[model samples]
Target: MADDSHLRETPLSRTELLRGHFLHVVRDTVRMPDGAQATREFVLHPGAVMVIGLLDDGRVVMERQFRHPMQAVMIEFPAGKLDAGEGSLACAQRELLEETGYSAREWAFAGRLAPTIAYSDEVIDIWFARGLTLGERRLDEGEFLDVFAATPAELQAWCFSGEVIDCKTLIGSMWLQNVQRGEWVLPWAASPGGADAGESGT
Candidate 1:
């Protein structure tokens, strides 16, 4: 089937709005599809990764941390932004260990997600880890969060009750449900630091 045509906006000018420690904001003036000029603002973000740390007894490792911008504490999977030149799988493994103190012998590249496509260029790679061993967390200096585990049923209830409202985690829960029910399949591979299999979209 042929897809409908897309509307392409042409950039007339762009101005650097702000450059912060992690976020780079920009404003662009563009010629819209209908030929009217308008300004659009957005942030450029370094990509990140999230890990669904599955244990042997059907629980998932997770975290609770406060986000200043949201003015609320959020429940999330073990996740972090990429360093200057980190691979997605490497970042996922590093973040999982750093935040939760667990390492896996088996890993799967579940998918990627754009949590906020309307105003930011942010992509989060999602991964699943199993065959677990636990150790001390190696959190970054100044980072503070509590790590815990929850059953899939508990997570689903949290989502339905508005307790867990993070977009990425909700997507993770969907993936968990589908995979557990044999409706979705993931390509499993050796743990991180080994050769990474290519990622697929959910």
Candidate 2:
């Protein structure tokens, strides 16, 4: 692997700008590798998990929720931010059940993604859940969304047609398509006892 220390930036000082329900904003003064100073402002997230749940009949669980920022109902996979001291797998399982009322007997850690790498220190763990069983959904207070199922093909078509534009969902579509084609293999296992994976210190 190539060494990247030469491109690293060291923080000189940091100032908290905003601390909301789940978003923490901060501004920082950093020393560039070239001995120059710069300012960087970004959001600090607790990280999150996005589950691409596969049903036995080849459909995937999906959600349509109104994102305040987008001001539109957006289609996405079952996802949520990690609770305090929560692991990625645990968050995935909780989100899958709470947001969609589905639980999986088998799971595979797909990968991770930083949707806003340039502006936010948020990293979302990608998970694949299969052998699903449906139950009653438990939505959080003040949370409103519609849960449904769509085939991988339908989801991919939306990605191409600019219908499903959520970055995580778009990326999830990529993972689903490749996995369906057998190009990307996932490490499948039975349910885990909740150990964290790929958590970024945001």
Please name the candidate that would achieve the greatest TM-score relative to the true structure. Answer: 2
Each candidate: how many clashes? 0, 0
lDDT of 1 by residue, 95-194 (tens): 8777888878888998999999999989999999988788778888999999999999999999999999999999999999999999989999886444
Give the least accurate 10-residue stretch of model 2, judged by summed lDDT.
193-202
Question: What digit string (tens of lDDT, one per residue) describes model 2 on residues 40-159?
Answer: 999999999999999889999999999999999999998999988987887888888888888788889999999999999999999999888787787889999998899888998899
* Best model per lDDT: 2
Q: By TM-score, how accurate is candidate 1?
A: 0.91
Decoy 2 TM-score against native: 0.93
Model 1, C-alpha of 159: deviation from truth (Å):
0.4
